[model samples]
Target: MSNQPPLAAADLQKTQQGNQVARTPEQTLVGFMNQPAMKSQLAAALPRHMTADRMIRIVTTEIRKTPALAQCDQSSFIGAVVQCSQLGLEPGGALGHAYLLPFGNGRAKSGQSNVQLIIGYRGMIDLARRSGQIVSLSARVVRAGDEFSFEYGLEENLIHRPGENEDAEITHVYAVARLKDGGTQFEVMTTGQVNKVKAQSKASGNGPWVTHWEEMAKKTVIRRLFKYLPVSIEMQKAVVLDEKAESDIDQDNASVLSAEYSVLDNAPGE
Candidate 1:
């Protein structure tokens, strides 16, 4: 081997640094979230009740609990988190407000999974209540043995009596929204109708739809009811986002699914 000249101390240090191994995806994600710029972006997107630090902690905790999330497209994952924060909902927590799920992007040659945000039934209810137009809202799955009857007309009426058998098969789902002005709106769907909606969801074969079938069914009815309720714009956006996540449609030719939430245009090391 031959060297034209020995590297200076500063040059040697620079060379060594340049040759260092790159950070793992997990490490890169954590570092990016900790960056001052990313933190500011999160703060700007988050509501007043949540802080950037808390949001970061929750996301990091979720990534640790589900390592697959670390493998997701970093920007898409961050965008989903920002969407949750903007909606005042926590992601991947016991509250079941929202979920961060990974799905294989058909476009990725590397078979990389992209993250999708699923809003839970509870999350939907929370968003609706935030509108302040609703005094109370609730959804339930009716079992085969339950006493249920509902009539929809000028005088809409609904009545249900729970069956003693707690394990009865689910036969129907319904949602009732009580408005602040003493008006009530309700929607009832037979299990067949709910199944039809489920069959159309790209995520029906997995994620919350599989693990939380009853919850998903209830949310389906509530989603139908939302169209008639006086909900906030954020709530409307959440519904659209939820539907998009379930459908997994590609509006643009991006490798990963894009959400409507505002996110940092340039992620770290982009």
Candidate 2:
């Protein structure tokens, strides 16, 4: 062992303070979490894509990538379209359509888009595991929890329509999340409506899409049962289409673009 001189009183105090801060990171988090206002804010800022984190850095990074339609619709528009693909919405083909809408539209309104998404089974399982709920998806549901869905609906006057030069008042969007039925399952739905779609071009046009607003609602039922579900190996195909694709909502449109996703080893739950 090497001989060492004793620390001065001032030095000892400084070292103790540094260790206390380093070791209490969890405490720091909990201190904020314990605040009712903080809890409410967390509840309000729920993620649209399953279990993504609520941290600003993580959330904004995902949003910057052509955000999922849901997240982009709910969060900052400019933030969502950051270098995202350009071929998915209209002018953008699969190469462009990373998100539901164009990234960095150059004309972002306060709130113009709203997208809905479903959480993946694997993500939910991971969350349950982290919560110490050891149960299979096929087994009797061991985790009964509530979740709040979040999306930025078009409210106020926004949306430059397709052809019209004038913009429209977007009004406010109403969204809510709830546990389905009297069971451990859950779902989110739109309660208030979006109104006032405006045209984009100076010439008269079809304006913005106004129909299909209620198409997202799900009839609620009490969930008396559920099981632990495994991560689906079937993979997911983008059922969406761009203006270049044939058929509007249907008809198989062969994607001319490649698909990708972030490495999700430590991703969060729904």
Candidate 3:
């Protein structure tokens, strides 16, 4: 509909090149993670033993190993990594300290997924020990063939004997925490109770609940036991985060990592 004549080929080529130069490069998960803002947040939150660069490398490797992580909402993924760093726990490795799991955001029209931070049973114990009140903390799964018994009131006691059947069905899981003051506290849950907890969880069908059922069961009992232990504030917060992850609650976006940092919707220059 324009009356003006078409531009010459040279002018058209120059315009196209200029547009190309003006366009920003597509941001990859690694690049988004490496942004100065993200790096600064990580450096400020990480413990003395951990460096932002090292944490970034760990997250980058995790993304590579689980491509689904790359597809997760970048802000949530970064926030989860920052939370792990703040707690001094390594994610997605053989250490089993913590994990970053991608979960579909059912509320999003685009079906964008978010990353949920899962603190492992080992991670829970690690945090609890930092309080200096606990001398030893451990969790174990009792199989059908194992001889296990316990008491609750005065003269409380527990006894367990190993059975040869390594593949025997799990009958119960328990966690015990011995305090520095020569006191011991423990919690035990039957398989039925553990199953009820799992059924209530939104992630019951996936994540550690699937691949590491025994570990998760042990963690569940440990969480119940923590109610009586003198754990640190960080450990308390970690438990809350773990519960939110299991329940698939969306209210954690603003408070998951820390009150100081807000999860950005997009990387800079996007």
Candidate 4:
């Protein structure tokens, strides 16, 4: 064995402290997760395997990508991060299993923003898996004689083969979701609806709905089916879209306050 001097105890402690510091998440809006008001809820919402620092890092990175999210209320943003963690989702991934969309700031008189929490297709699957609710999920394109149909099923037919129909149009896309005890649910979207959604998404600048047409179609049906499926409270919170359309309430409140201020300014003997 080669003879070498061991590192000093003080130096070793310093190195350990540095590593701990490096692992700590930087203080940002997400840092509010550790505050007493949020800490317990975050702990309950987060998966046992996830730590607060990791959750903050994942959400913080997402905020960097979509700068608008920075304007989101800190409490609401942290709640969204906790919801994402509960769903076992990483916001930094390309699929963006969860998103925190800010609304009402650029035009609202209150100048306050609310965060809309929306979950991706993968997040849906992950949430279903955790609850042991999903038995299997799949979709495929199949040709039956002269017509091409998207045949979706649980375990049997997830792949398409060239057994028939040398030439045909893919007329529809179907999605199958099999639940643990409940029977399978089949949802379909015709090519007409597909084109309509495509056009709408394009008009609104949603490139993914056009680029990943097939995947988006499948997700569309699955999200629809979620209306009938019972989900855990955490899952429900993660996927619910915050309704900015209801900003009318905020606007009305602002108007009422403005009227009161006008009356005060126009007093009879000012």
Candidate 5:
């Protein structure tokens, strides 16, 4: 055996102390989170009172619970995670109800498959609330004269409960964003817009558009109305996603290209 020097009592004591200092779970997680790749992955603002370590744990658990998330590309998966964290939305079918749809080959651009990120209506409201862009918002189907119209704003107190509002016969959906700066923006989707959105949804292979037509209409109105509102960075990312989706749809329509997956709804944190 080759010996450089004998260990002194101080060295031995220091070694013992170092060995005794076990890493906490959080600390260990932070070590992994400090990796340059991980730092780059988490480019969005984390939720209140949540650290990068905590977000990693949460997102990892979500990806584990939802196998669909595993099909996403690393970058897209990380983007979804970042969006969820920014929106304070729980993953894996939890509170925020975020879901990822991976489109293989169909919508891919530059040899990259498309991954669509979506959040529930509740998440949309939460994001808007967090941004303080809107004071209050609601949408409902109402009977106005001979036509069925969706009313939204301070005047509309009732939220159309989908199936429950069957008697009202929704012909249009309206979305109103009451600004914190003391003005209101409104968007209305006519039946024609609804049909167009439904056709787009069907063409995109999103789902049976008939079942989700109302939701899609409401979302269209909300998506359009929020475009002019002062939104957060998370919202800006969502807007970019929307614009890209629109471009994809336009390309599909004009050039006979079909997108198997379509980015749906306003982003979770937007």
Candidate 6:
């Protein structure tokens, strides 16, 4: 038998009090937000069909396409900027938007940008259409701080809807990331959501995409890697069992008739 005292209230109190979970106070406060409610509030507060990941991807994609970003051989501008967000995707408001972390040669860190990227709502939509994501970027800065706010949303010209004109507090997105391959390659390991509307109706349906190659879009980077055009994708709805697990029957032999004609005998006689 052990001599240690039973876990008493004093012991439990000491353990509970001594525990210090590692998270910044700001991080803790941000973590405390009610995510679902925040999503709704953000949706009500911001433009339609916009999210942070979508924003980041679109801007980086645009930069990658530009001649300056493309000439990224440890020369020129070494590739594009990556967008990151402290406020993760809840699909609404400032929290839903991603901050542009300009990557490559221009920034101190991997995706850190000396110049800002402001993506207007219309520009965001355009970027989405071309790059399969929704985010516009601008180099315009609204404030100066280490953790500065960087947000460019709902370009004033594109506010066709009444709610868009409402005084939605726009915020800036800021973060840092890295570039690779003379700035030829950039990666965003993320899961994201996109809204698709009926061709006729403007109503939205948020389609979610997992961050793997299995789910795909044509002309997306993965599609370009395929050697063959019109490659087939098999969607399996049912499973096939291993039917021939073991051989069911033994082999049978057919009878052979042998005559053994004397061709050699004729040669000997000759």
TM-scores of the candidates are: 0.82, 0.22, 0.81, 0.57, 0.56, 0.17
Clashing residue pairs in all predictions, respectively, total: 0, 31, 0, 0, 0, 21
- lDDT (0-100) at residue 38 of candidate 1? 66
Model 3, 2-35: lDDT tens digits are 1122122233234335343443212356765676
lDDT of each: 0.72, 0.24, 0.71, 0.48, 0.49, 0.22
Which candidate leads the pack in TM-score? 1
lDDT (Cα) of model 5: 0.49
What lDDT tens digits, residue by residue, belong to model 1 across residues 1-270?
Answer: 111221122332343355467766676577667767667767877778889899898888888888888887655676677777777888874777888887766433335667778888888876765555567777887898888999988899999999998898999889887776788888999999988888988777887889888888887888888777666656777777877776756312223232322211111221
Best model number under lDDT: 1
Candidate 6, residues 1-270, lDDT tens digits: the string is 111221222332343354488654223222222233322333343234555335434434444433233222211111112111211122122321212221234333323222222222222222222221112211111122223322233431111112332233322211111111111111111112111111211111111112211121111211122111111111000000000101111001112223211100011111
| Model 6 TM | 0.17
Q: What overall lDDT, based on C-alpha atoms, would model 4 receive against the true structure?
A: 0.48
Q: List model 5 lDDT by residue over 70-141, tens digit each.
A: 544444444445555555555444554344445555343334444455544445555565555456665433
Better of 1 and 5 by TM-score: 1
The pairs that clash in candidate 5 are: none
State which candidate, 1 or 3, has the greater lDDT.
1
Residues 87-109, model 2: lDDT tens digits: 11111212111222322222223
Model 5 Cα RMSD, 1 decimal: 13.8
lDDT of 1: 0.72
Backbone clash pairs for candidate 3 read none
Arrange candidates by TM-score, descending.
Answer: 1, 3, 4, 5, 2, 6
